[model samples]
Target: MEVDDEIGSVESKVDGVGDRLCSVFSRSHWDSIKDSPHELWIVFVLKLLSSYSYFSFALVLTLFLSTEFQMSDVEAGWVYGLYGVFSTVFGVLCGWVVDWLGVKWSLFFGAILGTIARLLLCFCTAPRSAVIVLVTALPFAESLGIPVMTIAIKRYTHTSNRTFAFALYYSCMNIAALVAGPAVDASRALFSDGVTLPLTSIRLSALRVVLFTSAVSTFITVLVVFMGLREIEVNEDGEIMPYHPPSRQVGAWKATVRVLKEKSFWRLVLFTLLLMGVGLVFRHMDSTLPKFMLREFGGSDDAEGVPFGMVYAINPAMIIVLVPLVGMVLTRVDSYTMIVRGSFVAAASPFWVALGAHYWAVCMFVVTLSLGEAVYSPRVYDYTMQLAGRGSEGVYTSLASAPLFAVKLLTGGMSGWLLERFCPEHPPPERNAAALWSIVGATSMLSPILMVILQPVLHPKQSPNIIPPVLNSMHHLEDDNASEGHNSESSNTGESDAEYQTGFGNLERLRRQHSSSNSSSSSSS
Candidate 1:
């Protein structure tokens, strides 16, 4: 009753805000949004812009290393892998920054670092050193923003709408990804003819021009954060929660350790490891899978970009469409159950890709993988929020990204090893690529399977031997229903029993008719 009343109050307040604000969209259109406060929309725009900035430069960075710097696969691994390593480490540490400084200052610090990194990428030409600066600086910037973003989402929305909020958030990330692919091509094309300075007569190449644009994007993002956003703690009781002063560095570290010592953290860590492995396989769609397609399948480099970009776009496209629908259905299901199911389904997508001899097969892979992604991906954070406490949001959120760090560290070099081992640099004869997918698919799929198998043991509530209250309640309902049937039969001179029989007959008849219609439709189609 309290929750219901609170929701009602929140709704009325939000509706009033929506009505008062004049905008391009009508009040009804604003109402159609997930009933969040106006402040959250501001945060949402920040997320969209931040994602665009991150992916735009990142999409081309690895390729630049290999093509421009002539870095070997192993050397490039450090360029890519170390960023993940440091980011993951910094993410864990940023818990302190987030807890103490709050989103405003943390983001302030991030913007500064991001601005510097973007500027360096725009002009720096020394191969190893430039890449190293970017890898280090980029994570330093994101270390604050990434976890803080999740904490903000958790703060600004209620539980009922949190998953939907995550969908919107994840979709923005995907939209960035969707745009980044084409943006890569567009950036490449913009300065292909080369650029001459107005008076200095200095020249610049296509890559440098693209990096300059990336720097501009970062600058715009910094402006948005500095001018538009306000930092606050979670909302409660028709009031904004005041930001409580968090502990200093040492104290924050102690608090983080204390949080980790709890059983839920360990359980989450175990589950994260399982889920992250599965994610590594799926995320390769962006990282290595394109290179795989270009090498194994025969197509000109120019044409390959379009198909691969389309393939990257498809996953996010499906996610944007399906997450809300899947969320509604999975609301009653346990998070782990959803994770288990999604992992198994994702495992098969690569199997189909293995069967292929063409680029279309990669499209098929994205289609199959996306369904499971929509179902399970949002649960990752939902599960984290459940485990975390109030100010400790940063600590837990960072830990949640542990899988991303782990995957980057493990898979960056591992991909090259697999490619060389299975596909070969130049094959004596075309080898079976099926074996490659089978190895990755099977190995990756083990994580979630292990999670499902271990869930009952780790969490008592999920144990099969334990009877749920709902099942016990249903038994009582059936008993009362049977008693009522008996009473009706006794009161109605057998007419009620006859009516029951008639109802059952009608139900069976309808079922048969439905089956017949389905068969006819199938045959006709």
Candidate 2:
């Protein structure tokens, strides 16, 4: 638990800094979060470290494979595209592992895989590591760690703070995103040829240095997670709740069978599909775009890293800046409204690249795309959290990856092939821009349409607030004056808030409406 002590010490230092900076906000805002548990802070640290490694890996992947294996754009695409496949497949397996061993061990195992994969990249040669093997193994290792942290956040924070919890998670990820870009660019410049150590006289390329550093960082992350994380149960209102620890805990396979049978779960599947479709466009920027730029625009590997890292970093940087503002504004709107409108903005970004004629178009694409992503991405997670049941966040969250799986299977594999086919070697970037982007754009546009069509069938009259309306209403009852004021206006809110809010205590019915849960509901604190 040395890592736990280290993290705690770091948090104390940051707390002092954070408090002084936050003094600009009104005191009430601080009061709401002043007493947040230490466990949530731990989750934030994990999010930051995990995202740093993941982003750096994504940033350098195409270049690494190209430089090392002498693979073509098409070949690099498939190897890189394999991440989508590995992540989709491994994400599910990780959920089961979480069910068997719990969140901490699931995370540890995933990090171990990632550490080894990155370490392998250090010593890899065209013949030694083998293209096919690295493609599959690296993705498998990296994908496993993602779900555990998300599940932990879900477990640790209740309805009262989930919005902020996710915001904190996203913000930390963006800070990493901000750093990952610089890391990639620096690595490229620092070791474009190779670096030699004075004592050992070992030389390594910038690529290997970055790759090995990532491996060491990931290994340290595994240790941090092992020593620092402890499971905490939470109820819907952001209150710490008792652990269920059911004597006969259900397995992931059974959960899968039951989840598949539920009509509500099928609706959940539809939502996942739509998310994946949009994500395909978002992902192309990482997996395919870097290689595409080098082939079409004509630059050395290190040079491309400059603008390419900015492209990857910009999206999350905007996300970090916009998260609080988006949360403040969008929370007043309905989920259906935000989902529809946000997807509209996101789908338009890639087409801009298709229409433009410069290297900077990619930057524009990320800027426009991130605006929509900021609004919708967290909502998608919130909605999925709504769909999960007692002690099933791990499994339900696992289902979220199905969309990425679909992207990998369907779109990811095709991206490289299209680039290879449409943009020939030594051609201008514009040569393939319209033909390739139009197809990507057309596929992306379908997601918002699907979301709009599925809304009524899946979540008829669903509101923006994910907090079970009853729990929200019940909180008002604790205050006599507030309850009286609420009673006076209950009729005008449409459902006679009095009747519906009162009746919402029947947790079984709410589960039926939001998700199909067979187990007893965990009542809100």
Candidate 3:
């Protein structure tokens, strides 16, 4: 959140400080966001603090392992990959738990868990213990917290502002990451080597200083969620709905099987899988890219050189600038189209690095990648929210990460091997940097291509409206079934494929056809 020098320049030109501030943003932007719920802002704060801690610590995690524990690049990559794999896996587990625990308790539990994990990392000196602490504790921290926050945002805001709410939620994460870059560098510079504890003869590395600060932020998140958050249900049309706790909840296994039985749920899984290669790009940014930059480009903060953390920050910073603008401008476009087009742009990003190993090329790669992520990533949440059934938002949203489970699972080992071969610390004279990124870029390019090829099969054809037509029609059909002597449980399981395919207009036609058939039978009799 540091103000750029441009703010000072604008201040000098404008009549007053308020006018300078006003000039930076248009009236329309402010007006559009005026009615957002107060809880949404709390969610933003929680997102900022929690994600800041996650990314800041993440930027240094591989370095921490390599330096503090004396792990090799390959070893660190496996552990780092394990961290990501478990994080997503736990996210799926936690999503089901959220349906049982409710949003507030889930947030509280996740924040406290993150705090404890950071504290554990601070004290652990051995590689075995550190790995144990990380793989066990930290994975559960933000993994569950993110989905809970997404559900919180969905509940707090009306449909009118919900999309922007998601975009802003994502922006808060980038803003955290945006600030984490300088913080990472400053922390590194402040402790040129490492700092010692006052009493116990324990030494803290520069990275641990960042970790400790993140722990404090997570502690603050606990306080904020406990004191600030409350339950508020918002219906599809922006109406305030009464909150009702389910009297009898199904077992997680049964609930999961129920969600899996739905064909649409399978489509979501397929879509998530198709996007996995591009998804691995994000995994590489944290697990592989930092080490790649330090080894290949060297870690000098200068005009000719770039620091890894600073380079890491570039993506989030551009995303912070671009997400709101994209959300605002692309309201008319379908989420499927946005995802496809944006994946193409993002998939092309690594080619910039393939063309050259210079800092300029790295900058181009990150900036281009950021632009594409800004276009598509927030829509991911929006699209997931659309597919989610009324009471199963957490389950459906978390299930989206199931495909990512396999993505991160393979990428961890894959990244380690790639770095060893192409961008190793000890270089063979025949190192091939272009081949490294060419592989990554080519892998990512499959997403958009397959997405286009599989659209008719996977994507639902619906108008680009606040609520998707299939979900809307499904809700209406459920109500009709309920009034016609069908119980909720029966309606959920007994619906045939034809009933599920009834789009908004087709649903009305089905009702008319049913009525006409009934009348014709009675008259003939």
Candidate 4:
């Protein structure tokens, strides 16, 4: 009875301490959150929905171009590459527009454009031209979604929790990608079998139905944004205050120039460039892989064996499991180290695809690739924002899209040329498959080497002593309290008044010097 009572008392004390700790931590986090301007929960949901439309289209398009159009590895590569190229170009322009016109118009326009692009794709018949035009438009339309969403996130969240916000954002993107694969497959199977559509005799291809469905989804997303998303004004404290209806503005060129001048901005640009190059290879794989399987692994008849589209699903499927694990690793490790290691994984992806003969091997290769992406993708964005600092979120995010565009241009041309060069005059399926995998593998390997060099340039080290002005204010309060105590003691003891005044003056001067130094360093570095 005595032992039981003692145990209960100890448990009660532990519970009390735990409760107090929880309250303190929760209050601190809440206070930090309250200081932020925008509502993160609402924005997170909107971004998830917006990403779904884009990912759905990409997944369906990859299978469509590879199977129905019979595009070779390089040919399919160009199709996907064009998407990045156009998106990157428009993303830069969109950044300027978002900074000037605000998030509302940017999102509105993006949705409208994305809807139109999908609609245009549904009408396309000629494979090459259709692929080119669709690729070109898809990026521009989708480009608006990320930069504006990022800006909205930055406007609302404090620096401490910004990484968490980006992680959530990226996870949403992967979720969309995960959903898109199976959804596209199901949608294709439905329409191609004449089960869902009105027409009985004419069974539309899966690609056509998927494209139409994606277009409708895009339109729906546009409607939602128009109805639900409101633009918030940023206050002097750098908090997003309240929603105000947007006003038309000319251009964000001046703001663009200011952002370009920052050292941190350039670092983000380099890092994203390297990261995007690594990611672009995978994007190309979505288009190229199905065709490679069909050509190399004997996936001719739909009823005879596993569908090539199903194989493409492996990466996203693995991502659902791997990302949280990667997140755990990120908690203990610096992002740059993860990125470097992830780059090697990315580099190895094309080789696995090239070497693998069986469906299972291809699936395994995809799993490896996805694992790397699961780590690298979220970290890249998180690191970029960390480097960007307070008000320059939009600019940094937009600039990050630039290298992707450059890669697209180079890859698009290279892909087309490689296909034409290796498999000239309607080459056999075996030769086409081999050539495609070889090119992809070579590029994938090259990407990591580039990233290794670029990583250090983009994320330079900063001194720990430099604190932001907001933090400095809190330090001043602590100093004031210390000084009060010292003066009270001096009064009691009748200490020298001149010495006390000198000490206070010196402390103030040191604080001012530190503040000035930080400002200069921030501007210069």
Tens-digit lDDT string for candidate 4 (318-365): 776666545532332335545666777766776665654666667767
Which consecutive 10 residues in model 3 have the weakest lDDT in total?
497-506
Question: RMSD per prediction, one decimal?
Answer: 14.2, 11.3, 12.1, 12.0
- For model 4 the TM-score comes to 0.71
Would you list the rank order by lDDT, best first? 3, 2, 1, 4
Which sequence of candidate numbers ranks them by TM-score, best first?
Answer: 3, 2, 1, 4
Candidate 2, residues 382-445, lDDT tens digits: the string is: 6666666556666666665666664675565677677767665554543567778778878888
**lDDT value, candidate 1, whole model:** 0.61
* Higher-scoring candidate on lDDT, 1 or 3: 3
Evaluate all candidate structures by whole-model CA lDDT and list the values in order: 0.61, 0.63, 0.70, 0.58
Off by over 4 Å in 3: 1-36, 197-200, 236-242, 245-251, 299-306, 460-525
Q: Write the per-residue lDDT of candidate 3 for residues 1-525, one digit (tens) a residue.
A: 248665664454333334323433555434434765567788899999988988888887877787778787678878888887888788787777887777778899889998998999977887888888777888887766877888787777643355556767888999999899888888877776778867778788787888888899899999999765666676534455555434126777777778888776877788878988788777777777777777776732121233777888899989988776665444334467667778888988988888878889888989999988987887777666656665677787778777776577578778778887887777673456698889889989998888887877666452222221343433432333333322212332322212221111122322343344433212211
Candidate 2, overall lDDT? 0.63
Q: Which ten residues in a row have the lowest lDDT in candidate 2?
A: 496-505
Model 2 stretches astray by more than 4 angstroms = 1-30, 127-137, 197-202, 236-248, 296-306, 403-406, 428-430, 462-525
- Residue 93, candidate 2: alpha-carbon lDDT: 62
Residue ranges of candidate 4 with Cα displaced over 4 Å: 1-39, 62-77, 126-137, 193-203, 233-240, 243-251, 299-305, 389-391, 413-429, 432-439, 454-456, 462-525
